[model samples]
Target: MSSTSSTVLRAEHIWLDGKLMKWDEGNVHVMTHALHYGLGVFEGIRAYKTHDGRLAVFRLREHIRRLLDSAHIIMLQIPYSEDELVEATVDLLRKQKQQFANGAYLRPVAFMGDGAMGLGAVNPTRVGITAWDWGAYLGDKGIKEGIRAKVSSFTRNHVNVNMVRGKITGQYVNSILAKREAVLAGYDEAILLDISGFVAEASGENIFLVNKKGVIKTPPLSSPVLDGITRDTVLKLLRDAGHTTIEEVTVTRDALYIANEVFFTGTAAEITPVREVDNRQIGDGKPGPISKYVQDTYFRVVRGQEARYADWLTYV
Candidate 1:
């Protein structure tokens, strides 16, 4: 496999359940309850190489807290404690430190294992953690030149149908459909709207709009959007830096077209600018100044250069 491929497929060990096992042994039966019913919750976390040459994960505890929240939302009980999972994640990162020198993406998933079938399927929860090197999710070029996004036909799931607060495994099927549609339509990513027609978020990232007045606006948590950890970090950072960040804003599709700037936030996408949406150019068709500021600041904080946020990092 190419060195830069996301799927390395060769890891020393995988933290499964409560023990580390060979990557080849990280197996699940075809009839696993989660596999059949999609009763799993997962988190995407990243560890970065600090300026001082140490490796640390950003917002590690916060991510774990969210993971637990996701699990609670689905009534799945993880077999391990948060402290144990955090320790396992740090240990896993240390074990793969050599291959993931460029930094790594950690996927920690908790799901229902093999057990009862049908509507009454009840099973013990299984947890697994995998670490691998990952570069910018939207590609370096997409980060620099900005990405093209299409408003998807797929509507965000109704809160009554799917709990928007939890990162349920099956909930991503909608994202998959929307993303595939956008990619096939020749766009970089897809933007989903709420059932009521107001703007929601991108396929795998949270959306942000910068109005001409220079205020930053994003869809509220009530808008059926995932409460993205990265989104929270950015808002906190902006507020700390004396910038106005607004939430619970109802942004229409046409509002995006005339916005001064637009961007997406998530652990994977970070802070990527949206240069155009539906062929409407955004602010000279480039990464806007505010977007650049947030991106640079985020990188610095993640890399341990910003001491004010140093407590956010967990060293491996």
Candidate 2:
């Protein structure tokens, strides 16, 4: 991580209305309608600097599609098409002179165009793509370090009320509050429960547990959890790599105390091992084997080692 190495790796490459801006220099309006109200859709996409020096984005099409789908759900009409998002990403990478030998991270956001708010001011949606050098979202706190997570006292917004499937701006208020509560409670993060008292997600990431039989289980999207792109990828990776995974509807507070192991996933956090849930140790209190497998295989797929998932990447 030398200064030159840092410069060579993970420099700011962001897009604003087809124009490239320095990551720090990127700006938006203070009065933007979406800023005031969660009226826009966004995606957290990742690209890695591969061993071959190729910068490959993981699940480009799928992530953009999700962003577009989110936009459509909110009735926001982005001026660009799916192809345009992909093209803008490519052109931005080339202009930034990004090193293709390694993969990098990517983010694309589509929001209502700048204006004061009226409830129905979404006919003109503005879209932008931004990317930078980002590492695992587990933060500087490693999974082995074992962070604590508090079960949020505040419940997540119901799908009936907030349309939880879409990645809207306001949806994160629940996340922010839960995270803040965890920090105040002297824990690393928070786990949010859906309205029905089922475990929906751990703050921004999805949750998984190992049953007494050593089977992997995760909550289905039928719960309040937004369909995470990484969660989807891991489900495919585990199954393809020959592991049995189950989607269970069970969400008892007791389930946390009886699990062999538990972990969380997201674009930012990647595969994070949860050693403790609510102060209870998870399976002798260490990152589990299955969690490690998911982490190892996921980075491989993102880095383009797994040809089976290569379609998920866009090599630049």
Candidate 3:
């Protein structure tokens, strides 16, 4: 749970209102509306070092679009345009990667820095950008053994009441709680369903299911899943490989038990396999072939190896 050290960490980087500070140095009002009432949005973007010692980020354009979309859902006006945000990320990573000479992680947030107690004040919009080393969020299982998850007793919130399309701060209270419950229950993570019991996502990651017939399936938008950048990458890779992709509403507490392969995808989770759900072993309880392929293709694409997906990265 400790953070990366300053010896390998870059303290100053670009952010608006425009000043660079240590990653842990900052002051936001404790009564900030986003903290009290969940009125802000954010994105997690990662920069990976290629085998060539150069660094790149996956899907720079798409992540910025989703960040802006999430901010719009809450009416938070970002001070920067999508292109500006991309440039900021590239710049910050370039600075950190130069000193650290390795991959770094970025957290770019758009939030209401100020809001009235009655929730009726003009939101003061701000962006806080930070970058440092991110060793791993899910560790080696991210591609090796894969992760094992549980069906959370908790369910994802309805989009009608809470915006599920973007990374909203308050919505993560739900994710944090569910993931905590699963960890205590002896699993690596939690998989939540839509209010209707349709498979939605695993805490912060998007879930994918593989059927016995070698078919790839995932819970589509009807299930209120986030349009994850990594999830889309795997989907596109599967399609380009001539595999049929089923992005429809799917629900089966039983399906997790039978899924020939199951995995989760996100900037944090990357491509993680799920070997079990609620103690039921998935496909002999191991990372399966489909999840492995997705991991291999995604890894190459992200690290600047595959030219076909070059448009997805922003080299720093």
C-alpha lDDT score of every prediction, in listed order: 0.89, 0.76, 0.78
Better of 2 and 3 by TM-score: 3
Cα RMSD (angstroms) for every candidate in the order listed: 2.1, 3.8, 2.6
Task: Assess the local accuracy of residue 83 in candidate 1 as a C-alpha lDDT between 0 and 100.
Answer: 96
Residue 83, candidate 2: C-alpha displacement in angstroms: 0.9
Clashing residue pairs, candidate 1? none
Question: In model 1, where do residues sit more than 4 Å from their true spots?
Answer: 1-10, 245-247
Report the lDDT tens digits of candidate 1 across residue range 1-316: 1111255545688899888888889999998988888999999999998999889999999899989999999899988888999999998888878776668889999999997888687788999999866777877888888999999999998889979999889999999899888888888889999989999899999999898888789998888899999999999988999985565588999999999999999998888999999999998899999899989999999999999998999998
lDDT of 3 by residue, 186-232 (tens): 77888998888778888888888888887788888756788888888
Lowest lDDT sum, 10 consecutive residues, model 3, at 1-10
Clashes counted in candidate 2 amount to: 16
Native-structure RMSD, model 2: 3.8
Q: How far is candidate 1 from the true structure (C-alpha RMSD, Å)?
A: 2.1
TM-score of structure candidate 2:
0.90
